[model samples]
Target: MRHVDELADRARALLTPGSRRVLGIAGPPGAGKSTLAAAVVDALGGQAALVLMDGFHLADAELRRLGRADRKGAPDTFDAYGYGALLARLRAPRHGETVYAPSFERELEQPLAGALPVPPDVPLVVTEGNYLLLDEEPWSSAVRPLLDEVWWVAVDDTVRVERLVARHVRFGRTEAEARAWVLRSDEANARRAAPGRDRADVVVDLDSGRVTPSAAPA
Candidate 1:
């Protein structure tokens, strides 16, 4: 595993004295994007902040209205345009004032607006999500342009799947339901996100904790 200190150093290098820079961590479900992002922020102390794409998740009512409740984790289930707008705002903050961002509440499965505040003095903002590197419309157009660098978190498929199942169970699903959800929902999103690995500036193998540069996309 690449040490958290190493990740912090790389993140630090992206900062400018008076400007904000966004570093993105992208990966499939259970690839440890959140964990790694937290570690990097912790290592950077108060100089860094985190903004999560999961916060833009469409509410359950909205999902049900769209007939997409069963496909909740899929890209279309989020407010891609809104997320992109938030990134834009973060990049060009007004009057060096503190900016607030929304956060997702896992237990409630809803987004709470203005749940996180990114202070103006913080030069580095670390954002993590499954679709940060996705090449699809709206998302590709909106997200990629704002990020200074995006690292893909890679892990063994089996380990990733096991972690997904365990996470579902911990969040209130029965063992059988958790396994089913992993296979039926999370796995589909994983496959959808896999191709983005080719577009990453770096790839972090969570299984071995090693970070490597990926060949530029063809």
Candidate 2:
């Protein structure tokens, strides 16, 4: 098991003078990708910034218009191409340009545009989401190349599902409704994303509290 500080130090190692690095955290639903990404970014302070892939989530109106509101977190519900473009810009920013990225408003279930301003000088841009390592047409072919490294977060499935249910309840689903959605929607999405773990540079096992990618540091 490894402490998050150890992970923070590893993230810090990616930083270098006059270059931008993007760290990606990818995992199944409720695997704590956001928490880890935020912690690492926080640990780095001014040297890093956070730009979430959830920010590319299709607006509720747009999702409903596209008839995909029922599967909100599924890969297709996001602007995959746009997210790739944003990452590419973060990877190679124009001089002195402060790039603005979108943010997701969970309570409102919508994405807010131009919500995060990432400066060109920030050495690390830490982004987290489920689909970063997804080897689909747009995500794998387009998005994967933009990231310097992607870590797959692994957790006890029972704990992960419980977190998903509780989160759904807290966000307005009834207890029964929450469990149903977690099992039906989140689980399905997890299956779709699980294969991407093979594409990750490392695996962060929260159950063991260790960074245990096949070739990761011991």
Candidate 3:
């Protein structure tokens, strides 16, 4: 996606030293997670770089070996511990340091190592994914200590499904496959994600681009 002019300004206003702020963008499978994250970074214009949770997807072979291929994108399917560790590093960045992070390959359906680099200079690191606000073990334990703030992007169920279908189609899934995937897999993920909205520091309504602030979930 192209740069987001608005998010850039917001990111700039939030930057500072002492703590590397991580803005967690959590939503259902096809809620434009990557697009919004990219737009936020593009808005930052080099002031920030992304550390996507997708990069931690278990390798396809690992998933198959674990017999969890059918649950890909589920909260349990990722290396949640590893993702949390990386965020910890980003928060207390050491000068002159460079860290390598993983990236997921959609066509290959696998995760590649050393795909993202977080130099010490970037003050803000925007990490987007489906489970940032999940309050369960391992996954729940991973992010809270690392984030300065968390923003939940809220899109209507109908539009989100449409967006997911379009995305799967763009990625070469058949119409039938896309719709089925959205209904079965993504919708399940969405349900799991719903409880997180109450935990957000800021909730964004993508349909209207309106933001409502709320106290962090108890």
* Span of 10 residues, lowest total lDDT, candidate 3: 1-10
lDDT of 3 by residue, 27-109 (tens): 77777778888878876777788888989998878889999888788888899999999999888889899888788887777
Candidates in order: C-alpha RMSD to true structure = 1.3, 2.2, 2.1
* Model 3 stretches with alpha carbons more than 4 Å out: 1-6
Candidate 1's residue-wise lDDT over 2-95, tens digit each? Answer: 6888888889999898789999999999999999999999899999999999999999999999999998999999999999999999998767
Candidates 1 and 3, the one with greater TM-score: 1
Model 1 stretches with alpha carbons more than 4 Å out: none
Candidate 2, pairs of clashing residues = none
Model 1 scores a TM of 0.97
Query: TM-score for each prediction?
Result: 0.97, 0.95, 0.92
Clashes of 2: 0
- Would you list the clashing residue pairs of candidate 1? 1-208, 1-209, 2-209
lDDT of each: 0.92, 0.89, 0.81
Candidate with the greatest TM-score versus the true structure: 1
